[model samples]
Target: MKEIQQFFIRNFIAVPVSFGSWLYLLFGIGMNIFPATGLFIVLYLGSSFSIKQIQLSSNLKQLGMTRSEYKHIKNQLTSARFKVKQLNSFYGKVRSVQAFRQLHEINTISRKILGIVKTNPKKFYYVEKFFYAHLDSAVELTSKYSMLVNQPLKDKDLKITLQNTRETLVDVNKQLEQDLRNVLSSDLEKLQMEIDFVGVTMNRDKPVLEMKGDKYNDRK
Candidate 1:
């Protein structure tokens, strides 16, 4: 949808540039309609494509990554998004209100983690387990839990399995929370460093101001 919007904007901008020349060739120069139409189409398409490539390069530069690195990060994000979608799908299958809420919490955490890494593609490295194993575990366990919860028979053993699944999901939720912390750790560290630097700068200036105040008082 975003791409479509961009394409529309690009072509809208490209139209006047291409159309004026095409019109001159067709009407003013009395050129053949068929050839002029062909040239116009080619020019229009080429201009739009150039606009797209320029925008793509600009985006890659802003992200501080090469085209290949950007593509790799994008692919990883796409895969991670699919896993999150899978986790969300289980919510409807969940029978118990407790189970539904549990799945919602897990999905919420997954989304937060995904959103953070997405904006800073470099943070994708910080969440290997999240992209690979931990998320898969959540989806798989949820699948089993959802399936079993909807089963018609609730035997003694089945009840035990359900309880175990719920307990396991709690553990998975904790792991997801840990994953969120892991992704944010560097950001948190940077923030604290900034805060400390500001504090130290203020403290260092305080003594100078105090000495100046003392001199001013003596003169007074």
Candidate 2:
């Protein structure tokens, strides 16, 4: 029932509401049928502007804010990639250890926890391209993390925890990368299936909407 309601709202209610408003604005105001387009303008603004919708139901089951986290992680990765590309372009060099560390930091936090939590294999594959595109940088980053983890230190427990975290992160990245590569074909196929579903539904209902619009205009 909820899904059907949502579908109706998205296609039937929302689109028609938007179209009616724009039509009133373009026609009713231009034709001097009303004192002003103020009412239509208000409704247009209200409906067109998006409110931040947190799907609390899905989040409760998923354990994380999926879209927000995905956007943040993607931004981080893109920024890192840009910086590395800039360095290589300027100096004709590969990468610095510190630069690699920054890359590693972004990847470790992005994949080890957030990416896995999202559980979207297609997204994982897309992100893997980001890593693979900078394979040299990634290898260097892994080496630097390895060195950091192996460094002898006085605080044994703290060192152990940090090493364990680093190793775990590394293992997770490798495993996920392989999984992404292996499933790329199937995941992409699934994406197409979803796209086809949306396309068919949209095509099926478009004429019904046109008919409704004609009726609404005739009534006016």
Candidate 3:
């Protein structure tokens, strides 16, 4: 059933319209006037509308999302994934432990953020906003720093800029962690509140005894 639904989502535009066109062709052969032109128009319109309907229904069923919401989340994930790949590639080229260490940390956190987005796409709006705000700049800075480090010349200014960029990337990694925490803040808060409630109840309802002259008396 899942495979069938996936097939429909992928081929909804072509399959139905093609089937209808074939049927129309078969029937129109017996008629006095061939309806080739009309059939083409109907098939075109039918495919366009069917594509939209299928997309909306698929989004709702798969992600509990509207068409636009699903598209937005999907595009954001794609962009984030691309940035992660870029960072990972740069990490490979890095020779200095200091630079590679920060890039590795950034790559790990970036991948974690992507995993969170994939697992809970509905909760991805905050993550998407954060990615747009800071992720691209981090990628750009890392790429530039990697290029500078690879150059043979030991220019003092270039080294200074690279060190500064490395610090900024460290901050960016921290920002990614904070952003992920923000996305899960509601769930974390709920969990903490539940724990507190449990602790209070446990303490309040705990068994107590009254001692009378070394003899314990149970108070029911």
Candidate 4:
């Protein structure tokens, strides 16, 4: 589904606009009224404009993203998702329960981070470094591990390789969790500060009444 959407965004306008231009050129040729060079120039310019418009519209449709924001973070977003997709592609090939579990965890964390980025693209800057540093390694290691475990022979070295990959994946999972925390750190701090301020204000604004009961008893 995602691949289809990406293909559409890339070609939806370019193909149709280019084809329409060709049709116009053919019609003009049939009528003997259009200059070939002029028609070619128009087609080139129109196709370029159509491509730009489609890209702009696709970027705008991204939640919490402006054109500038999308441009700034597009690579990071694309890279992260590409890594996730790479890991997902190995899902069916995962033979061991441990490998399957690790892949599932990786996919879940990757998707969670992707979801956060989608909703709060401004935080993409915070996460961009982490994704660049670790995402590729995680995907590669997971893929290698999946392939290793799926082999029919269980050699001593294969067992060691599997163990080492599993261990590395545990570290990768920790890094992913840390990345998520880093992305949310500012918001979490803001929420904590607000809660503290409200608590203090409520306590300070509470009225203290001690003499009212005594006054009623005295009047009686």
RMSD (CA, Å), candidate 2 to true, equals: 19.6
Candidate 3 ranges with C-alpha deviation above 4 Å: 1-64, 211-220
What is the alpha-carbon RMSD of candidate 3 to the true structure?
A: 6.2
Greater lDDT among 2 and 4 belongs to 4
Candidate 1: tens digits of C-alpha lDDT, residues 42-137: 999999899999887976787788989878878878988898899878878998889888899889989998888777877877887888888889
Q: Clashing residue pairs, candidate 4?
A: none
- The per-residue C-alpha lDDT of model 4 at residue 30 equals 61
Best by TM-score: 1
Tens-digit lDDT string for candidate 4 (1-220):
4436765654675666666666676675563435644665576667767766666676578655677767667667887788788988998988778778878877887788788876667787777756787678788888888788778999999999889888998898888878888888998999999999999999999986677546636656
Model 3's TM-score against the true structure: 0.67
Clashes of each: 0, 0, 0, 0
Q: Per-residue lDDT of 12-98 in model 3, one digit per residue for the tens? A: 666667666766676756533346656666676677667767666865787777778777788888988888888878867788898
Q: Go through the candidates in order and give each one's C-alpha lDDT.
A: 0.87, 0.51, 0.76, 0.76
**What does candidate 2's lDDT look like per residue over 75-172, in tens digits?**
65566555445333322222346434544554544344334424442254455544454444444444544455555663877667656645654654
Ranking by TM-score: 1, 3, 4, 2
Go through the candidates in order and give the C-alpha RMSD of each one to the true structure: 3.7, 19.6, 6.2, 7.4
Colliding pairs, model 1: none
Per-residue lDDT for 162 in model 2? Answer: 55
